[model samples]
Target: MTSTAPAAGAATSGATSTGTSTATSSSLSTTINPTFRAPTPRHSSFTLSTISLCGQPEDVLDLQRGSYALWRDRVEMKLAIYQVLDHVISDVANPADPEWLSLDFIIKGWIYDLITPELRTAVSSPGATARTIWVAIETLFRNNGLARAMMLSDEFRNTKQLENPLSVYIGKLKAISDEHRDLGYPLETHALLLQLVCGLHERHETIGKYIQTEAATLDLLRLRGGQALHG
Candidate 1:
């Protein structure tokens, strides 16, 4: 005689021996283009509040772990920021509005200030694993877009020092792109690849101040795409 048992991969329909119930199983579907929803605006001091709770250096590690988990789980936050910025740069309709560009700059400035130099040094150190580098690259890309915007803005011309990290960040971005390529992943994983390449090319002349390249302007043009560059 055959015993009554749920088939493999199927959930029990009713009460179990332990007075527990099971829900029916369904096939799981996966997709590359996950649907992204916008996140609701949180209190502007949310990051600060989280940091404040971590009162000491030892607590900072725990805070970072918790923060990383939150960032990873909150798809809406990533979508509203990085996904929206990606569309803006690609000139997608509705998503490419200039107002969003301004908001991006403002948000980036806040984020950049929040990332202390100590944090940057820690993230970029030789001990940093691939996952650490990936997270840092994501943070930099989200902020570097605003740096590029500031570099192009007339008001920022008077405040050149504020724009210094744009090139340094690009270098780090290129390094991350190279790492992704070496790992045999598609270039799309390095979401800011196109922007980094273009930004490097556009600022090749001035970038020498930050990164001393022996290659001349003509050589730099040849190295990158051989065309007039625009920031």
Candidate 2:
């Protein structure tokens, strides 16, 4: 009976030890593995919208040397490509729209970069919107007096071939003619062709003479000749 009692007590002790070991493991697991999860970071404040517009337009708006018409067309085309033409054309602004206003300022910076220093000062005003600056530029160029037209005409008549290519010389004349035409004095087509023929380099004498002789029916394509000569 005494041996049997010791065996029974030994069995109870073993069972109690096993139960205590299981309880300790379960308590450690619960304490190590928590149910609460931390939040993920959003980074909303650090985020910024970006645009891909870089570099100045080829035709910078300098009235003394650059073509306004060409500059205006190029600027508009670039803005159209990036889908931001509305910023320069539309006067309406929604102050609540942060994205729209952000793009507007970006475009304004682009224009400021692409114009001449003289023009920059002329168009710049305190608190001017992009549209306002655009309109001011248009007014400055398109609303000058008769003296501007006269000066342009003089420049047109005196534009010589110099060391430039035939196409480049013609392009210069055409730009002047375009500005002149804008000011209500369109150069006659024949006169423009004559000016083009007269401004050719001495090396192109043969083609120049041919063009002069055929001036009556001279197609514009004749000026856009062999790539070698045009270049």
Candidate 3:
């Protein structure tokens, strides 16, 4: 009768087969060892290139020449920066990205530096200075419809004053507006004047209300044959 039990050689072969399976499993365990864990969430630093101020020379010369083209160029540059920042905010995943927001604030500060002194003189002297020409530029900013366009951008919507560098310039704008009112200027300049006031004070409802009240005094002058028709 043939024995069902394995012989000595067969038993030895079975033990070797079991030992080989254990070695293969141990090799896989070594090969699959963890290298590094996942990174934790943290703030990342970023950088942005500065915006160019094109057409500045032409605008400066035109200012001296009393040419509308110079004023137009200046207004265009201001609006262009505003528009570009607005687009950047929309394209980026994070609306509050610090680098992008800082660049926007820098551009705005440059514009304020370029215009505030001129604005101050114009508000003080009414119709008797180069600052009066600046009023036309301000009108271009508003009438071109870029101001409202900026307000529509995610940058404007998501912007927080505490995190924004532009907050300082905005405060400067409010100070300028307050100073203008104390200078006794009439409301005919309100459209341009209030546009600036509103641009800077948009975050403060009280300042906006004050601008509205101050702007209410503007009266249109009638012209007859290039001569003032209304007193």
Please name the candidate that would achieve the greatest lDDT relative to the true structure.
2
Give the Cα lDDT of each candidate.
Answer: 0.37, 0.74, 0.42
Candidate 1 has its poorest 10 consecutive residues by lDDT at: 21-30
How many clashes does each candidate structure show, in the order listed? 0, 0, 1
TM-score, candidate 1, is: 0.20
Task: Superpose all Cα atoms of candidate 1 onto the true structure and report the RMSD in Å to 1 decimal.
Answer: 19.3
Tell me, by TM-score, which candidate is best.
Answer: 2
- Ranked candidates (TM-score, high to low): 2, 3, 1
Model 1 Cα displacement at 84 (Å)? 5.3
Ranking according to lDDT, highest score first: 2, 3, 1
Angstrom error of the Cα, residue 23, model 3: value is 41
Clashing pairs in 1: none
Q: What are the per-residue Cα lDDT tens digits for candidate 3 across 135-218?
A: 444554345333333332323233233434333544433333332332333123554435434454345556446446655543
Worst 10 residues of 3 by lDDT: 220-229
Task: Give the per-residue lDDT digits (tens) of candidate 2, residues 1-231.
Answer: 246888899999999999999999898877787884566542221131354333654556775655567678888998876666777888788646767666667777778877878999999998777788899888888776356778887887788988987777877887787777776777788888887777778887887887777678664445655442344
Off by over 4 Å in 3: 1-58, 61-70, 74-95, 120-231
Taking all chains together, each candidate's TM-score versus the true structure is 0.20, 0.67, 0.22
